[model samples]
Structure formats: C-alpha cells, structure tokens
Target: MSIFKKIKGTFQLLKTIDLDQLAKLNEKIDLSDAIKNLGELDERQLKGLMKMLTTKAKKGQHQLPPIDGDFYNLDLKLSKEDRDIQLQVRNFMEDEVKPLVNDHWNRAKFPFQIIEKFAKLNIAGIAYEGYGCANKSFLLEGIIAQELARVDVSISTFFGVHSGLAMGSIYLCGSEEQKQEWLPAMQRLEKIGAFGLTEPNVGSAVAGGMETTCKRIDGNWILNGQKKWIGNATFADVIIIWARDEDSNQVKGFLVRKENPGFKAEKMEDKMALRIVQNAIITLTNCSVPESDRLQNANSFKDTAKVLQMTRAGVAWQAVGCARGAYEAALKYTKKREQFGRPIASFQLIQNHLVEMVSNLTAMQTLCFRLSELQDQKLLTDEHASLAKVFCSMRTRDVVGRAREVMGGNGILLEYDVARFVADAEAIYSYEGTKEINSLIVGRAITGYSAFVN
Candidate 1:
C-alpha cells in the first residue's frame, strides 16, 4: 500500500480506539491476523474500513502539495495558443532530444538526422514578421529558446547561429530581394546559415579592431581574414561575413557562399562545453563575392550591434532554461535518494539548497519575461539586453553549482544531466559577450562613459 494510505488507516484506528480498548482488542486478536481476517471479511466489513480510511485521507489532502517551480502561475498569463506551443516544444525536447543528447555531446558530433524533425516545428525566425516566418511574439521566441537549451545547449547554439545571428542579420540589414531569396528556404531548413564576425585576433573589440578586410575590385569584393569560433560554418550553405572595407575603413557585411574558391572552414575540436556544436575556424583568402551579395544596409558596426542586441536577450533565456533543467533533475533525485532511513530532501540543508536553486530560477524567468516584453514592444536597448545577460548568466552558475552540490557525486556524471549544465554554463558565460564586456555595456549606458578601449 502507498504510505499515504497506511498513514490514513493508522489515523482512523487512533480516532476510535482508546489505549484500554486497543489493549483489550490486541489481547483478543493479533493486528496482522486481524488485518488478514478483515480482508477475507464480508463486503460490508471492507466497505467500513475503506470508508474510514478515505475520510482520514481527505483531511490530509494538502500535506504533500504538487511540485511546480512556477509558484506564481506565470503560465496563466500566456495566451492559449502560446501555451500550447510552449508545451509542444517542451514535449518535443523531452521525448526526442533528451535521450540521445549526452551521447552525441560526448562524441562531439552534430546529429544531422534530427534537422528535418526540428524544422517541422516551424519555429525558425519565429518572431520575424515576414518571409515565411511564424510572426510570433518575442515571448514565444524566448520560450522556444528555453526549450531548446533545456535539452542541449549545443543544439540551442546551432539554432541561434542559423535562425538568430545569420537569418537575423539578413532580416535586419539585407535588401528586400535578399530576404526573398534566402529567408524562405532558410526558414524551411533547405538552406542553413552561419554568422562570421569574431576573428582570431578580434573578439569583443571587433567594432574598431576587425582584422577581416574586404577589398572591392572589378565589381567584386575579396574577403581576407580568419574567423574563430564560428558555429555551423563548416557546413553552412551561406555565411554572413562581417569585415572592414579597406578603402572606406567601415565595417560591411557580405553573403559569402560555401562554394567560394577562397573560403575554407575547418572544425574546431576539444571543446569542454557545447561540444555538440560544430564550431569552425574559417579562413578567407580573397574569397570573392559580387558586390550585389553585400548586405545593403550594413554600413557600419552599429548595424551589427542591432543584431547582437536582439539575440543577447535570447541567450539570457537559454541560461534560465539551463538552470531550470539542473534544478528539476536535482530536485527529483533528492526526494528519492535515501540516507540513514530517511529521504535526503527531509534534511534542512538539502531543502535550503533546493530553495536557493528555485529562487534563482524564478528570478531569471521573471527577468527574461520582462526583457522579452521590452523586445516585443521594440523598446529594448543594448543596456537592457546586457543587464539581463549579465544577471542570468551569473545566477545560472549559482543554480547549477547548487544542483551539483545537492546531487553529490552523481552531479559530475553525464547520465544525471546536471553535469552538462555545469560545463555548458561556462561557455554561455563567455560567448556573445564576456561578463566583463556585458557589464561595461550597462555601465556605459547608466554612467555615460565608455570604458572600452577604442
């Protein structure tokens, strides 16, 4: 019998039998034997016993409440259609991606087979308004990002590179003809894309220190530089390359095709986090492209900042997902793991850890929600995105650390899931913009001072 049913039966016996009456009944009959006799008793006797137990159980109904992290019922705020999409994405991640993620992550290989299945969700460029996009709100986009990262950060990164960084580059800066040519097929997963901006020598300082150079000659542009940590670049059909024009000294974006004779992308290996993402070290040696292939509106680094501002909010959402995944897994394990004849969750210290994890998770969810609201309203600024990124990434590290602490040794094992988040959190902390860089962004906005070297 369930412990709950046993407790209810004991309570019912206590209410009717005093110590003297119980002693007299015990003398007349063994409790175990009486229970067996009762089982074999007539239907009327069984009904009486069951009725007593049910009554006691009804009184104890609220003792063990359901486990739900979103205590505030934030889900109720979502539209029915949006909530359905959120559940669909969550189900997809739990069923399809969760089972095979650790193995692929250990092997550091992209699961190309799942691309077709993922595309069927029709979530790429979800918030964009045109070119076969879903035209969903930014709230839905944030939910999708969380769902993706909850299962595997690498897949989330790959999706962000193609759907957000690369496709967003076109959506925000490319000509109308370019969007019509690329966005539709790309949305359908017929053409994959990559973004190439950070170079070997220039990462956070790429704005003014971009070493990637583009020289215009004979109606063609020759791109010559190396891009490091370029996710999906090796197999991408088209790469959005950002480089400084040699003559104008202003950064410009170009649509560099994979078949270009001078373009070479080699796989970067031995990564400790986001291992399933196939980051590439790309070398451009006079990679020739027609002038028409250049991004029409990308006149300067300010244009690139617009794309980063949009996607950085998504990264914060991804961090929240990572933390939530770790917390849930740890919470479930603690309730079942036993020590000294009791559940570990019963201990005050373990509960403290769980509470702390949930607190951080709740804060992150609320912050990301507001951040997406600002985005949907078109009121989001660089400082807003940076602040969210800074806070969420930092808090995620804390949540994952507590998750690991509560799980004990199993936390370090990949099969348990929390270990991967711990490692992946490190990568999220550094990418897009480092903690130092993101903090500087907020500092500059609030203080009206530039701390970065120009």
Candidate 2:
C-alpha cells in the first residue's frame, strides 16, 4: 500500500477504539513511537499488525448470549406459522405493553388504550371451535398465556379472566344460543367478561361451601351473594356467577350483566400484587337474570370444574412466563451491572442462581407443553392440570426469589422489574389453585383417596 493509504487505514482502525481504551493501550506502549514504526513496516507486515491489534481490541468485548428464557429450545417444536404467531404476540407485549407495565402496575391502573391494538391480535378463545374462535390447539393457547405473562403478570391475569375463565364458561357450558350471542363479540374483544366463583368467605372449599344462592322466581333467576377477587369485574360487560340453586340445591351459573340494577362491583384496593388487574368485590343483591342468560348445561360443581380444569393449565403456563421474565431480566442485569470491577454474571454465585432459575424455568416449560398436549387430545384430567399448576407455581416462587437475591437491593426496586415478578409470583402461586389445594388434587388421584376433608 502507498504511504497515504496505510496512514488512512491506521487512523480508521484507531477510530474503532474509544479514548478510554486508547489511553489504556497507550499506558502499555508508546502510541507515537508505534505509529512511526508502523510506517517502516512492509505492506504484509502492516496488514498483520492491524489484524493483531483488531483481535486484541475485541478480546474483552465478547458477544453476550441472547436473553432467551427457553433454555431447552422448546419453541423449535412449533411450526413456522405457530412460531410466527408467537413472535407477533411477543413483539406486541414488548412494544405495546411492557413500556407501560411498571407505571400502570405501580399506580394500580389499567391502560384501556391498548384494547384496540390488543383486539387486532384476535387471540381470545383461540382453542375453541366456531363462534368466531380460532379453533387452534390448546398448546397454542398455553403458549400465548406464557408470552403475555412473560411481560406482565397483571396483563396475563386480565386476559386469562376474560378469555379462559369467562369465555371458557360460556363455551363449555352455555347453550348454543348463548354461544352464538356472546362468543362472537367476546372473541373480537368488543365485550369483556369476568368469572365469579370465589366469594368473600369461599375459596378452596367453594365447591360445597359456596354461600351464593340463586332462586327461580317468575321465570327468572335471582342471584344473591357477593364475589370477592373477581378480576375485570369492575368493568366486565358480563360475569358468570356461580350460585347454588334454591330448588335443585346444585351449583348453577348465571350470566349477570354489569348494568343490572342490583349488580355492583367495588374495586379492590391496596393490593400488593397484580395491581394492574382490576379485581373487584361484587355484590349481587336480588340481581335478577332471565332464564335465557343462565348457563344451560352447568348444573353442578362438576360442570364448573370443567372451566377451572381448562384454565388451570393456562395458570401453570403463566407461572412459567413469570419465572422466565425474571430470569431473563436478572440475566441481562448481571452482565451489565458491574461490581468489584467485574460483571456480576462472571461471579460463581451469580451464575449459580442463573443456572437454577433457567433449570426451573425449563422444567416448567416442558411440563406445561405436555399438559397442553393432553388437553388438546381431550384426555386431560383434573389431576393432570392440578399437578402442573402445583409444580410450576411453586418453582416460579423459588426462581423469582433467587432472581431477587442475585440482584441484591435492586431486585426490590420496581424499576429493575424483578421486584414486580417477585410479588406477582406470589399471586400466581395462590390464585388458580394454591400449592396445598393443587397438591391434594394430585394426591387424590395417585392414592385413589380424597383428602380434601376429614
């Protein structure tokens, strides 16, 4: 090369290193002397020196591995179209929901503005057939739940209340006429729904101890009771209220409209978790519903279990997402967060926590994958769903706890995002089915004995 060309190339190479790096290099060698010596070198020798310096400059700047929670490559099991849909939902959550999550979650408010964009996704009731549903496999539905919760558990809870519990109730138990009337609108996200099964005094034992009562009066059902912790109830267009019938003494479901004069929903406040979800304490004082609005096929708690069974699987997947989000966030933070003049991720203890988090996350993902498969095959039982819910929720708590531990004090800060996951994991652990309750369900199946009661 010519003298001018060699000097220009040398200057261009120098531009790649910042002043700090250049200063560090100068401490080791005299830069002016090095440049003068470089001019004397032959063309081949100059090229060799440039290559050596370039490699040396890039030595400490190793490329970081991508922040993916799917450690086992489970997504490879999905087809091209399925993978595309997953990416679409993931992008929507990252671009549209994630930016607003911390703020909304802290303020205990919902961002109603995203409804239009969310509606365009057309994912409600995805696993069901007809009634404007996607007729997709249950595996896809679980994956969608995971993707949503991976960003924010509150948003996932909102979607689950509307699509899984509320819509599933109408789909699995409602009459054909009711399905034609409500499913189309709900599937489009034009109408929101809520499920009301737990009450102020009823939770795990709600199956038999449900205090809500429904009476047939004048060809209509009168619902009288309160439902606590009803997600989306404050603004739901319709709520599936499960009550014991005065006549049949069996659990029945009624479609209670929000506009009913006797129907009232009070927003629950001071929540420590899932603040973005508008949980409500609903009161039904003589709330009357037409016979047409009643769930025709829901005659007992056994029928109600159908909806819970399907939704429980989704809850397990939500736990997986919650753990994953924490793991990825912590992983990213560790690599960038410097301590003792080195990245924390390089520390043995920090790496141990990350490995544990990923291991639990991977196990949860594979378990849910099989759980969904059983669901799609129509061979899933209450015990199968319960087992996954129990395992994943418990593991998620451990993962999130370690995530917070690794971050030290920043893990408790909401801005870092790990704190939110820590709190949300608690909710997931207790909500769909508590660790104790779900464990009993599985224990009953294995032992052929019901230990729920004495």
Candidate 3:
C-alpha cells in the first residue's frame, strides 16, 4: 500500500487510545517528530515501518454490528401499558440519570435535584392502595427497579430504601392514620424515607439479634441504640427504626422522625462501591416518639419479616439491572473496539464472552418475571424470594466479571461505566440478604431442616 493508506491504518489503531494515553506515549516517543521522520524514510524502510505499525500478517478489517441485550424479547411479555411504563422509565434514566450518574458517583454525592423530577413519576409506594401511590404490580415495580439500577445502582438503592423498605414497612404494618400521614407525601417525593434495620452488630440477624431498644415511658416510646448501613438516613425525612421492646423482648418498628433532638445520623464515607448512596450510622440516644408513631400492626419480629418478604423480590430485579448494564456496555464496547484489524466482536472467543453475558441477563430477567407473577398471585414465600435473590445476585457477579474481562483495561474505569456495575454488584449481592443467608432460607424450606440459628 502507499504511504497515505499505511499512515491512515496506523492512525485508526491509534484512535483507540484517548488524549491521556497519547500524553503518556509522548514521554517515550515524540509523535510530531515521528511523523516528520516518516517523510525522510527510503521506500524499502517505509515498507518495513508500515509492516511494523499495522502488523501486515493480520487479515483484513471487518466491521461488526452492534450488540444488544434482551436477546429473548422479554419486553414483549409486558402489556402495552406496562411496556409504555418501561419505556418511560428507560427514557428518564437515559435522559435525567445517565449523564449525572458518573459525576455524582465520583464525587460520592447524591443529586438532590433529581428528586423533584422523579416525584413526577409517582412510582413510590407501588402496590399499595390509597396514599397517592400507583398501586401497580410487583412486576412493574421490578421493571422499574431494573431500569433505575441499569444506569445507577446507588439511585436504585435510594429508591429501594424509600419505596420498598420504608414505605412498604408502613403499608404492611402501620395504621390508617400513619399511612394517611406519610404515604401521600412520600409517594410524591415531598417526604423522603429510610429503613433502619441493619445495625453494626446485627446484619444478617436483624430478625432475631436486634440490639436497638425501645421502651414505653409516660405514653411515649424512648428508643436507644445504633443502626448501621442505614441508607438515606443522613437526610431522610423519616427513618423506620426497628428496635427490640425492652418489656416484651420482641422486635418492633417505629417511625422515627428526622428532627428528633435525640437522633444523630453520621454519614458513612470511604466506600468503594455505591458511593453515591449516603449510608449512615444512626444513634438514637433516648429518642422519643409518640405512641402513635409506633407501627400499629408490627407487634413482633414476624411483622418485620412481612416487610422483608414483600421487598426481597425487588432486590432480585435490581441485580438483573446491574448485570444488564454491564453486559450492554461491554457488548457495545467490544463491537466498536478494533483489535487485530477488526472489531473484537468478530472473534470467536469474544463472541463466547458476549453470549454468556446476554444469556445470563435473559435468564435472570425471565426468572424475575415469573417471580413477580408468583408475588402478584400471593403465592410467593420466603423461600421463593430467597432463591431468586441468590441466583440473580450470584449470576450478576459472574456476568459483570465477564463484562470487565471483555473490556480489558477500560472496564475498570468509571468513565466506561462497567466498573460501577462491577462494584455495585457487591452491594447487591449483600443487599436484603447475603448469598449464604438467602441460600439457607431456600435450603431449609426445601429440605425441611432449619439452619438459621445453627
């Protein structure tokens, strides 16, 4: 080939690296002087240089088509109305959330601005009647979770804490007065909420090992103890704090308002994943709440279990979204990324990686779809949600690993978007319950052997 075509091919490969890489490359060799040196070369030397630059041994370049997820067309399963809802969320995530995700994640800050825009969707507290909530299906709720998690898991975490954990706690356990007071504003995003069940010493054992104490005093409940890993507690309007009743020794829930003088919430920092979520350590030093604020129907730990059961399905769907985001980003990158004189997607080995990712993503989506069906049918149980959570979270870890592997070095950078998923997957794997806990729940149910305490 002539020098013009040879240089063009060389530059095409060089385009793969950005300005920072170019600056680093300049430290070893000056690009301007090198280009000038090319003109001085003899014909034989130029041909040899061209061979070295383009590696003439490689075959011709070929453009590969773009890769996408949802190979099975799972979206078709939804009704027209639900499909429209999915598109509405997808468009919102792409437009309002996508551009700001990386920046907020990098700064470890939440974009408070999005709350007003998000409230307009009126999706909070779904599946509950009245309270200004949508009262939609769990399937649609799962789809929304997937959409939020696709762009940013931290936002999904925030939403889950508010919509699923906090609001669901009240919906399932609070009285009509409690629901009427909080749900409407919460659904509209005028009031933010947080769920405080996980404590520093009480994580997987939140059901039975809760250390926070609530005591009745002069017609008021005085709460004391600490809660760890409480999402949105730092700025939430209300935090549903779970405490053991000193007199009864049973776990009870309380609607702890944010402004209580005895309540202290310190922001937990230096997180490696889901940095945008403002998790906090909450200390209730004799925090006083009126008797009316106590969850009227949450008489025992069993009530907490009810709220968890209702929300665990959403966690499974969030894992699916996390995996899908990574898969889609990696797939797109591999297709456009030129390697060996052609797109990497053309390579048989690369195709294997891409196929595995989409396969797992599709399988997880289908599983959650059925899981939601069971939930809507009122046939869902602890074991059912536990199974889905274990499978999806574990599979998501695998999918994100493959995604990172396919992107090579670019996979780890936040700018490329796959790294966040890889990190956020850790949080998802441990959210609601860890893989071990969820598996145990399913194991005991199937085998008729209790293993939680032992």
Best candidate, TM-score: 2
State the local distance difference test value for candidate 2. Answer: 0.91
Runs of candidate 3 exceeding 4 Å displacement: 1-67
For all predicted structures, in order, the TM-scores are: 0.86, 0.87, 0.86
Q: What would the per-residue lDDT of candidate 2 be over residues 350-436, giving only the tens digit for each residue? A: 999999999999999999999999999999999999999999999999999999999999999999999999999999989987889
- lDDT: which candidate is best? 2
Candidate 3 on 72-131: residue-level lDDT in tens?
Answer: 767768786776677677767878999999999999999999999898877887777888
Candidate 1 C-alpha lDDT tens digits along 1-454: 2223444565576569798998887899897786666544332234345655555555534333334555555677788688767767776787788889999999999989889988988899999998999999988899889878987888889999999999999999999999999999999998999999988976757987999999999999999999999999989999999999999999999999999889999999999999999999999998999988999999999999999999999999999888888888888889888999978988999999999999999999999999999999999999999999999999999999999999999999999999999999999999989899999999999999999875
> Model 1, 11: alpha-carbon shift in Å?
32
Q: Sort every candidate by TM-score, greatest first.
A: 2, 1, 3
lDDT of 2 at 145: 96
lDDT minimum window of 10 residues, candidate 1: 39-48
Cα-based RMSD of candidate 1 = 10.7
User: What are the C-alpha RMSDs, in order, of all predicted structures?
Assistant: 10.7, 10.7, 13.5
Which regions in candidate 2 have their CA more than 4 angstroms from the true location?
A: 1-57
- Candidate number that wins on TM-score, 1 or 2: 2
Model 3: residue 449 alpha-carbon error in angstroms: 0.9
